[model samples]
Every structure is written in C-alpha cells, then in structure tokens.
Target: MASRSSSAAAIGRAARSSGLPRRNRRRVRRLCNMAGPDLMKTKLYSVSPPVKAKATNASLSGPTRYSPGMSTSRGRASRHKKTFPVPPAPREFQQARSRATYERILAAALELYAEQGFHATQTPDIAERAGMSVGGLYRYFRDKHQIFRELVHRGLEQNRQAQDRMLAAAEAGLVAGETDLHRAIEGVVDWTWKALHPTPPDLLRTLAAMAYLDPAFAELTEQYDRYERKALSRLLAKLTSRKRVPSPLAAARLLDLVVPNVGIWTALHPDEARGVKEATVEMIYRYLADPPE
Candidate 1:
C-alpha cells in the first residue's frame, strides 16, 4: 500500500511539473493508485512521453526549414490546380466557323469605323456590334489595326471583283456589236455613278481621312486607282478605233475623274440626277467621238 502511494504521489508530481492541468494530475494520480508499483511505472512512462524543448533560437536566427517532399500552401495550390488545354475543333467545322467569324468581325469593324472613324473606334464597340465579346474578336484579329487592314483589303477585293465583272460584260457587249458608242458611254457613266454613290457619304469621308493617315490605306487606294485606270483603258481601246483624244491614257484618266465627279454631283443634287446623268453621258460620248482642240 505504501509503495503504491509513493508511486501515485510521484506521478502526481511529475504530471504537475510537466505542465499537465490540475484535473489531469488528479486523474493520473487515481490511475497510478489503482495499479501495482511496476504497472504504475509503465503506465506513467507510457502516458507521459519525454518532450524535447523546441529550439526557439533556430527560428529567430534563420529562415524557416521545411522537410523534403513537403510543400507550402502556395506551392501545394499551384501543384494541384492545372490549366487544361483547349481541344481543337474538327477541321471542317473549325474552318467554317473561322470564316463566318472573320466575315462578321470584318463587317462589324467596317460599319463601326465608317460611323466613328478609325482612330475613334474601339475593338469592344466592334465586338458588340458583331454580337461577340472582345476576347472573341481578338481570336480573329490581333488588334484594331489588323481589323482596319483586313476591312480595307476586303473592300478593295470587292471593288476589284465588281470592276472585273463590269469589264467582262462590257467586253462581251463590244464583241457582240450589241453596244454602240452611245450605249457604251451611257453604260460607263451609269455604272460609275452607281458605284461611287452606293457607299454612304460619311463612309467615303472616313476612308478619305484614313487614306491620309494610314500608309496601308493609301497604298490600297493607289492599287485600286491603277486597276480602274487599266480597266477603263481596256474599255476605251475596244470602243474607239481612232485616237479621238490627245492620249488614250489621258482620256481614260480624265473620264475617271469626270465619272466620279458626276456621281458626287448627282448625290448633292438628287432631284437633278436624271438631267446630270444624261448631260454627263452626252459630254463623254462627244469627247470620245471628237477630241477637243
């Protein structure tokens, strides 16, 4: 009994010294009292393992050390979180979708640029007009400049195609001997007037402004001018056998200016469009038939 009391007393002292709470100390004392001396020693030793004091100075003097294969919160988050790659769409579907998106973005950009001017227009405005997000717009165009380039190029291509078709029709008419000088002259004037006036005045004004500021636009304009001049020269060659003007090339150039001018005049004076068209056709036919001194 005395030996058991001694053991219980020792455990109580040890528990208190080890910073155990008073309640825990009393519990340990009761447990120790219930056991034999040898059992009490084993139970006490098993319950109270030796606790090494933490090296506080190690933390104060150096950087925190983590065990090998351990990761920090940031590192763990990065390791577990991944960005999955986007799978590519099927070839045909991808191509069709791309072409459709390209056209939509181009059309939207053209309308916005025409309305707002190139410098004043933004990508978001274009995307919204096209019914897409800004990021979706970027999938087709790298920037607004790219969109502008594509829009100008697309317009130039459409103009080229229209001119080609008109030239082909004129060539066919000439070969068939179905178009006389009067009809040919009238056709040329009517076509030129329609082409120039089809585009809105504000859109033409925007293009003119852009041509001044952008070298690409200027170059495109020059290319189109060259093409028109060439086509007009070809048409004139087929129409006139005699050199009615000082130079056929000069005549073509002059007619180009005169045709567009008549179109602009008609636009400014819509009520006089018929009179202007007839008068302009007469002037061009007379000039082709008889050269001015």
Candidate 2:
C-alpha cells in the first residue's frame, strides 16, 4: 500500500509538471493507484491480435516507446528476430454480460471523450454516461487512458478492415480488367474524405492533443499511419502501366498522410468543400500518375 501510494504520488507530480490541470491530475493519480506500481515497472509488448501489454516507465524517467506488429519494442532478446516472446495472457472479458458492459463503457467513453475533451472528462463521467457507477466502471478499465487506447485500437482495426474491402474490390476489378486504376485511386481518397466529414472538429482536436501529450497515444497513431501508407503502396503496385517511381513510398505517403489531413479543413467550408476535393484529387492522381526523378 505504501509503495502504491508513493507511485501514485509520483505520477501525480509528473502530471502536474506535464501541465495537466487540477481535475486531470486527480484523475491521473487515481488511475495510477488503481493499476498499481507494477504497471509502471512493467515493459510491454504485443501479445496477440487484440491483447497488448504496457510499456515500462521503471522510474518514470522517460517516454514509453511503443512497438507495433513485428517491430522491436526495446532490447533484442536474441538474434532470432522474434518479437512478443512468451505471449502474455489475454485480458478481455469472456462472459457475455461482462462483454456488453465493457462495450457500453467504451461507447460512452467515445462520446464523452469527444464531447468533454479527454483531459476534462473523468472516469466518473464515463460511468455516469454509460449508466453505471464508478466502481462498476473500474471493473473493466483501470483508467481513462486504457479506455482511450482501446478506442484507438478498435478504430484503427475498423479502418484496416474497410481498406481491405476497398482493396478487394479494386483487385477484383483488376482481375476482370475493368478497374480504371486512376478512378480507383480517386475513390479511395474520396472514401477517406467522407469518413472524416461527420466527425466534429472537437474530436480531431482531441486526438491531436492526446497524440501530442502522450507517447503511447502517439505510437498508436504511428502504427496505423504505417499500415495506411503500406496499403496505399499496394494500390500503386497493381498498376501495370505505372512508371518507375524512384520512391514508391513517397507517393504513398503523400496520399495517405497529406491529402486527407489538408482535405479535412477544407471541408469546414461547405461551399468550397467540393472544389477542394476535386483539386486535391487531381493533385494526388497527378502526383501518382507521373514518376519523379
């Protein structure tokens, strides 16, 4: 108990030094205490598809470095190049009732995180929003950060699934020799643009803030960023008439990272949105169409 209290206090101090407001400091402290001191001392790795472990902060000395699928997290155990040695046991709920409650908490947290801002929203707020008590909420997640991480993971997975479907259609069209590669590229960009349309600016800002403030969150975003870029690269590889672009990844990066981010802001102005999309689409298609020396 003494050690745990000390760990929580240390985290609280870190939170304060990190410029978190009073309310959020309390929330951070509570979360640390709930997870216990061992949570900080533990070094994390990807366990399986859904379950993951925590990254070490052993002395709260530095930011946690996150490793996504098949990447090295920290030290190399051996020259075997194996990651996730000794897979960690799963943590997700197995029971139907628990699963329902768990989802309810995530659903409520998703709304509250955007509506109230992640820092401003407390665990109690999430519980209340989910029609549960603080104690019940604790049963599922140790802290709000855990909930945020889960939300991001699930969102990224959903996006990858969507991309898979889109790619499948494009590939099927290619097999039939009916796919206009340029048109398929435009469709992909348009799909990405529309996906961002309904999300309020507040949520986007919230995501940006989280990524800025938390190393783990930043790493989580980067993992998906890598995936999306690769997915874009795969699209171009299928084009038989494609020129020999010196760097295919560069082209992929522009479409995956640049277009959608810039396009989202253009959407803020409803009248100009259509024009901006057309201009951006043309820019992306042209960039991919021609190879740079």
Candidate 3:
C-alpha cells in the first residue's frame, strides 16, 4: 500500500508542473490581444523592457513630445499665437495744406470778430472757432491786429481788382466816345457808390475804433487813407480828362465826396452814416450830374 501511494504522488506532482507553463502562456496571449494587432503580429511570447521614469519625464519636457491627443491641442495654441501686422503713415505732404489751414483760420477769426466786435472776441474763441490750437494761432499771427492787417490787405486787393474791372469798362465807354456827359456821370456815380457801400461795416468800425484806441495804429490808418485818396484822385483825374469836362479839378473833387464823408460819418456816428449814405449819394449825384452853367 505504501509503494502504490508514492507512485500516485509522483504522477500528481508532474501534472501540476506541466499545467503551470500552459496557464502563464494563456495569460500573455490575452495581454497581447488587449495591446491590439501591432503587438499580436509580433512574436507571441515576446517580452518588452520596462519603461524608465526618467525617460518618460524627458519626453514630456521636450517641445515636440506629447500625449496621443495633446499634440493637436499644442499645435492649435502655436497657430493662435501668431500676430497680425499694422499699417504705416504717408511719407510726404505739401505747403498748400498749411496755406489752406491758415486761410480757414483767418476767415473764421474775421467772421467772429465781425459778429462780436474786436474787444469782445477773444483769441481763444477765435482758435476754437477756427479748429486750431491757440498756440498755433500765435505762431502765425502776433495779435488780433496782425490778423486784421492780413484781412485788410486781402480786402484791399479784392477792391483793387473790382476797381480795375470797373475802370476798364469806364475807359471803354470813353473810347467809344460816349456823348451824353450826364449819362456818363450817372454811370460813374453808381459804380463808385456801390463799391464804397460794400466795405464790411464791422471792419470799418474796428479801424475807426483803433484810431481812438491806439496812437501807433492811428498812424498806420493815416497811411492807408492817403493811399486810398491817391488811388481815388488818380482814377477821377482819368474820368475828368476823358469827358473834357470843364472845371475838371472841381468835378474830380465832387466825385471824391462820397467815400471820405461816409468814412468820417461812420467813424464819428455809425447810426448817422446809414441815413447819410443815401442822402450823400443823392447830393453827389446832383453836383456831378449837373451841367456847368
């Protein structure tokens, strides 16, 4: 009975040893199946090396190395970081723009000065109305008077242009030998009267005020008045010579009556000038249009 028992024990031990290898092989096969087809196509009993912690961390630290889905997210972040470019300014401009700006500023200042009167209108007010800096305004003009001087110069030039045209027309009539001296006198009177009446009332008043306010300005005013008289006297002389009108000097003096009186009356009493303008025009007409007896 002891011998039989020993043989049975040896057989049992061999069966146990044989079954252990088969069970381990089946576990490895299932693991390869879970790893997918790439692992399956390789050696069925193959064993890979264990991953090192340092190598895994080094891969994560590098720029290119990333997890399965993380590479796409990082690429998107890189694309978003790119910046858009900006545009540049122009290289050059002309002095014409500056001249235009100056003219605009001057016009705005004049219109404001005319509306409010010079003393009441401020430089800052002019700058604001002109859409310019007050500092910039001073750079161009020293004071309101300087700006006024420019305005006066411009106005005088405009007046001179108009007078030239009118004189041309008058001279043409003379060359045609316009026979009726009375009709010619009436035509001259009308033309001269219209020209005098068109001077801006506020600018004229401001000039008159300057004579009383500033002695230096009063001298400048005298010079301009002299220039005006000379111009008028020259033109009147031409008119008198053309007509062969008798007492030519006296007739020229009569022609000069409208301007000085209007200016003087306006300076002394502005309200009175409105009334005198019409009356004076009539008076001059009567004197000039009448035939010498």
TM-score of each: 0.61, 0.66, 0.51
> Tens digit of lDDT per residue, candidate 1, span 75-126?
3343334221222232243577788888888888878876877778877999
**Cα shift from native, residue 4, model 1 (Å):** 91
Residue-level lDDT of model 3, residues 151-255, one tens digit each, is: 655654555567667656666776787624445555555555565555566766765675677444444445444544555455455555444445655555555
Question: Candidate 3's C-alpha lDDT?
Answer: 0.55
Query: Please, what are the lDDT tens digits per residue for candidate 2 over residues 42-97?
Result: 66311223223344431111223454322343422221222211213345777889
Which residue pairs of candidate 3 clash? none
Better of 1 and 2 by TM-score: 2
List runs of model 1 lying over 4 Å from the truth: 1-95, 291-293
Candidates by TM-score, descending order: 2, 1, 3
Q: Give me the runs in candidate 3 sitting further than 4 Å from their true place.
A: 1-93, 179-189, 196-200, 215-224, 238-254, 260-282, 289-293
Please report, as a residue range, the 10-residue window in candidate 3 with the lowest summed lDDT. 53-62
Screening candidate 1 with a backbone cut-off below 3 angstroms (N, C-alpha, C), the clashing residue pairs are none
* Model 3: residue 293 alpha-carbon error in angstroms: 5.3
Give Cα-based local distance difference scores for all models.
0.68, 0.68, 0.55
Better of 1 and 3 by lDDT: 1
